[model samples]
Target: MPAVQEVEVVVAHRERATLRVGDMFLKIDADPERADVEVQAMAIAPVPTPEVIWRKPHVLALAALPGRALGRLGEPSAASSTAWAAAGAAVRTLHDAPLPPWPGRSLEELAARLDGECEWLVTNGVLPVDLVTRNRHVAEAALRPWKPVFTHGDLQITHVFVDGDEVTGVLDWSEACRGDGLFDLATLTLGHEEHLGDVVAGYGADVDLDVIRAWWSLRSLLAIRWLVQHGFDPSSPGCEVDVLRARM
Candidate 1:
C-alpha cells in the first residue's frame, strides 16, 4: 500500500475542520451528533455521494469524489448547462427517496430566525434598511407550507460535483432531512440564476418560480450575518450580498 500522505486543510473554523489526504477527506466536526446525521444521511440518499471511509467519535472520513465541484460561491461556473441539469436530476432523485427520519426547520422556526437576522442586519447597518425591508417582503412567499420531501438542506453549488454533463456526486449531508423540495432547488441555484431554467427542466416538474425567488431573498438575508462573522466576504461578486443587491 502507498504511504499515508500529508494532510492539507480544506476548510477550518471553530465549528468544524475538513482536511484532505491523498484521495480521502477527514471531517472533524465540533458536534459529533451532526457527524452521525451526516453518516446516516449519506447511507440512505439515492444520489451518488462520497464513499464513507470510516467514522470515529468526532471525525468522519470519506473517499474523494471523481469530479470537480460544479461551481464555487463567488465564481462563474465553467460547467455546461447539461451538467447543471444533471445536478437537478440528482436532487430530484434525493427528494423522491423516502423521507429521512429527522425533521427539518418548520416554517415558524425559519420565520423567527429570519426575523432575528433581519433585525441584526438593520441594527448593525450591514445593509440599508430599505433593501432589507424589500427583500423581507419577497421572502414571505416561501414561508407557506408544502409537502415534505427528503432535502439536502444545504445544496450549495460547491457541494455538487460533476464530470462532463453528469453529476458524479454530492457532498455535505449534515442538514439532510424532510423539508420543502423547492428549498433545495433554490439553494442549489442561489447566486447562479442563469442556470435556473436548465435545473428546472431537468427536475421534470413544474415549480413555482415565485417561491424560488422568495427563497433566494430569504436565504441571502439569513446567510449574510453568519458569512460575515465567519470571515467570509459576502460582498464578493456572485456571493450572498451581491445576490441581495441584484433584487434591488
Candidate 2:
C-alpha cells in the first residue's frame, strides 16, 4: 500500500476538529456521545450521507460525498435555483421518513432557551434593546405546537452537498432528531432568503412562511452569543447579525 497521507485540518476548535486526507474525512469531537449520535443518525437517515469508514473513540472517519457544499452561510450561493430545489426535495424526504428514536427539543424547551438567550443578549449589551424585543416577538411565532418529524437539526446550507442540480449528501448529523420540519427549512434558508421560493416549490407542499421567518429570528438570536464566544464574527455582512438587523 502507498504511504499513509498527511491529513489537512479542515476545521479545528476546542470542541471538535475535522481533517481531510485524500477521499476520507475525519471528525474528532470532544464528546464521544456526539460521535455516536452522528453515526446512528447517518445509519438511519433516508437521504444520502457520507459513508462511515471507521470509528475510534472520539474520532470518526467517513468517505466524502461526491460534490461540493451547496453554499456557505453569510454569502450569496452560486448554486442554481434547481440545486436549491433539489435540496428542498431531499429535506422533504428526510422529514417524511419515520421519526428517529430520540426526541429533539420541544417547543417549550426551545422557547425557554430563546428567552434565556434574549436576556443574555440584552444583559450583555450585545444588541440594542429594541432590536432584541422586536425579534423576540417575531420569534414567538415558532413556539407553537408542531408535529414532530425527523429533522437535520443543523441543516445549514454549508452542510448540504450538491452535484449537477442534485443533492448528493447532507452532513453533520449529530443534532438529528424528531423536530419541526419547518425548522429545517428555516435553517437551510437562514441568510439566503431569496432562495425560499425555490425551496418551497420543491418541497411540494404549502409552508407557513411566517413560522419560517420566526425560526430565522429565533435561531439567529440563540446563536449570536455562542458564535461570539467562539471567536467568530457574527456581525460580518450577511452573517447572523446581519440577519437580525434585516428584521428591523
Candidate 3:
C-alpha cells in the first residue's frame, strides 16, 4: 500500500488548502474550483468569505486559489491590460469589503518586526554589516497618517489569479492588516509600471497613486535589505534582486 502523504495543497499564492491526500487527487495548475465565496460573489454582487467545508483539530479554515497569475501570462497588450483591470476591480472589492477591525498590529509594527528580525540576525552574526540599509528608514518614513483600510501586505501579480480577462481569485490573506491600502497597491506596482497604470486606470477613483509608488519603493528596499542580510551574493543569483533595487 502506498503510504498516504499528508499535505497542505498549495492551491494558490501564499495559501494552502489542507486535505487528506488519499481522499482527493491533486495536480499542479489544476483549477479545482472557484473558492465557494468566489462562486457566490460572482453570482451576487458582494461576496462573503468562504466557509470552511472541513476542519481539523485546532485548524480554523482553508481555501484554494483558482486561475493563473497575471505574470505567468506572457506579453503585455490590450488583453493583458484588461486582465490587469479585472484584477484591480477584484482588489477594490476586497478593499471595500467591511471586515471587523484587524486589531493587532500596524504596518509600522510589521516593519519594526522585520527590523527586529534583521537586527537579531545581524547581532547574532548571521547577517552582513550592510544588512541594515537605508531601506528600513524609507519604509519607516512611508508609514504615515492615512485611513487604515485592509491591506494585503504582499500584493503582486503572483498573488492574483485570473481567468481569461477576469479575476477569479485574490490569493493570500496571511499578511492582511488594517493599514494604508496604498501600501498593498504599491507592493503590486513596484516593478511593473505599465501593469500598475492599468490597475490605476481601472481603479478610476480619487486614490493617491503616488502614495502607492512610495510604499512600493520602500517595500522594495526592505526586500533587498532582507535578501542582502540573508547572504545571497549580489554577483550570483542575487544580481536580479540588485537590479530590482537599482530600478527602485
Residue pairs in collision within model 1:
none
Off by over 4 Å in 3: 1-52, 58-66, 72-79, 107-111, 114-141, 221-244
Q: What is the lDDT of residue 228 in candidate 1?
A: 87
Q: lDDT per residue, candidate 3, 85-146, as tens digits? A: 77677667766766434443566676676677557646766434453453444455566787
CA RMSD of all predictions: 1.4, 1.5, 7.4
By TM-score, the candidates rank as 1, 2, 3
RMSD from true fold, candidate 3: 7.4
- Candidate 2 to truth, TM: 0.96
- Across 49-97, the per-residue lDDT of candidate 2 in tens digits comes to 9999999988899998998998998788999999999999999999999
lDDT of 1: 0.93
Model 2 residue 58 CA deviation (Å) reads: 0.4
TM-score winner: 1
Question: Which pairs clash inside model 3?
Answer: none
